[model samples]
Target: MSLSSFGFLIEEASRNVRRNGLMSAASITTVAVAMAVLGSAVFLLHRVQQFMDAQPRQFEIAAFVTMETSRSKAAQLKAKVQRIPGVYRVSLVPREAALRQMMDEDHKAGTRITDALVGANPLPDRLDVQLSDPKATRRVAAILRDKDKFPAIEHVRDDRETLDKLLATTRLIRNVGMAVALLLFLATAFVIQNTIRLTIFARRREIRVMQLVGASSGFIRMPLVIEGVFCGLAGSIIACGLVLLVIRQVSQFAGRLQTPFAFTMPAAMSPSVIVGLLLAAGAAMGWVSSTLSIRRYLRRV
Candidate 1:
């Protein structure tokens, strides 16, 4: 279309919104509420996935050395474990150090259970192993357990069960969020579609007059479609603002937590990306809803 024609379409679309101010405001508000709910779910799922991905990097494997193993032999085993593929780092924790740590923890908790041991440090020397890929945790633990290859080690332990539970929980959260988000998306679209249809209905007489004056269906539909897009965009901006405010408040609350429950914001859930996603979703919903609504009405006319 030419500049003049495009300007006319924009003007007409603007006029339509102004003429139906109440309905337009209602449409914008409905869209904002729907988008906000859907956006929160999507954002939460993204953060959970990010947390799950980072978990493996923090997981550790522990290999306990037998009481008969000499300090020199334990050091050799640590060096050997470090040389293994996928092993990121290995540090030796002597039984004495372990005993001290355990006692310190017990004291902090107001429990003196270790006081009964009285110079009998039953804690064994262990190798704390970090892995480049946590998927190899079991394999590396098995290697450390092999008696013929590493006779100094008596027990192999890892956070495999904890990791499994964590992964399963995140997966469940992600799947449920996705399902809910999908439903909300459809609901949002439906609301926009119905709202746009109402706007078209209110302007049916004007549309008929335009057609009688030799206006093509496209000429009549373009302005309404643009109006729908405007409404969608307006709603999305509001939704994004609300979502950011909530996220900021949530982050503040999380920071105040004094336990392991405290967490950092996921890098993937950046504000820029969130804003862009909501804007795109809003614009697309408006365009699709208006196009479909106008097309169906034009056919019946």
Candidate 2:
């Protein structure tokens, strides 16, 4: 089509929207509410996943060295553990240092119990291991415990049960969020589709007259598609504005809290990105829903 034809179609779309002012307002408002709810759910789930991903960095495993193993041998074990695939860092704590730490802890608790046993420190030297990934905790712990692999090591300790529980909870939350989002998407599409159908129904006679006058289907469809796109774009702007406002307020509140649970939005969900996503989703939903609505109606006419 020529530039003039495209311009004319856009004008027609605007005119249609103006002519049905009440329905257009209702459609835009409905789309905005639906998209807002869906977008908020997505934003929340993404943040929850980020928080879960961060928990692994603090997880640590302890590998105790036998009393017979010299400090030099424990250093060698540290080197070996450091070479493991998921190992982030390894530090060998000497038996003397471990005993001193225990004594300090006892003293802090208002007791002198551990002071007398200073010379008879029975605490074994241990390697404190930090992991790059929490999921690898079990495998690394198993490797540390292998007698043949490191005979100097007496035993390994890790909180596998806690890690498993954390993973299970994350998966459950993600699955449930996805299911809810899908349902919201279907409902939003239905509303947009029906709204567009109402507009088309009001203009049925005009469409038939154009068809009889030898206007191509493309000519008849272009204006209606443009109408949907406009509505979608308008609705998206409103939804994005509301979501951004809530995000800003929540982020500020989280930052002021003096706790480990304080949350800031992840870098991936920047304001610019959020706006782009909502606008794109709204426009695509509008285009597809409107096209489907009109195609079915045209078949009978």
Candidate 3:
């Protein structure tokens, strides 16, 4: 379209908004509210996924050796375990270290359990193994249990259950997030469509007059479509700002918690890219709603 045509479309869209000011405001407000909720959910899901990805690295495999294992044999076993596929690092914890750890735990628990009172330190030397993939921990544990490899092996411990729980929770959150987002999107579309319907109804005579004057449907519809797009763009901007404010407040609150919370801002995409996506979503909703409302009126006229 020429610049003049574009200018006329803009002028007509502006006139439509001014003529139905209250309905326009309502439409923008509804879009903003729904978009804000959906945006916040998306941001939260992204942050949670990031946090989960970062936490899996902290899971470790504890390979406990039999009490009768010699120090030299334990060292050899530790080296062998480190060579296993997916194993990242292995640190040997001597029996003395284990005793010290147990004593520390006892102190924390307010229980006075001393090595002398226990007659001997029953703690055995073990290897603390870090794995590249937390999912492969079960296999790694099985390998350590091989009698021929390390006969003195006693037990293996890893946060496999905890990791499983976390994964399941994340998946649940993702499913719920998608469902909520879809519902909010449909609600927003309905609200916008109804709002446009009202606006079109108020201008029923004007649309009929344009049709009578040999105005093509495209000429009549272009301006209204532009108006819907403007409403969507305005609403998206408001929604983005509101979402940022809510995220900031949530981050501050999370920071004040006694236990550390892995709260990070959603991944930073280019500002242009984010704005483009929001604008596109808003525009698409607006255009579809406007088209439906206009079609309904045209059929009657």
Cα lDDT tens digits, model 3, 115-205, are: 4557577778989888888788889888887878767888887778877887789889988997998999989888877877776777778
lDDT (tens digit, per residue) of candidate 1 on 73-127: 9998899999999899999999999999889877976899999999998999989
Best by lDDT: 1
Can you write out model 2's per-residue Cα lDDT over 86-174, one digit (the tens) per residue?
Answer: 99999999988999887876786689998678579889998989898888998999988889998888888897787677668877988
Better of 1 and 2 by lDDT: 1
Model 2, residue 128: distance off in Å is 4.5
Residue 224 error, candidate 3, Å: 1.3
lDDT of each: 0.85, 0.83, 0.79
The predicted structure with the larger lDDT, 2 or 3, is: 2
- Give me the runs in candidate 1 sitting further than 4 Å from their true place: 65-75, 82-126, 131-136, 146-148, 256-268
List pairs with backbone clashes in candidate 1: none
Best by TM-score: 1
**Backbone clash count for every predicted candidate, in the order shown:** 0, 0, 0
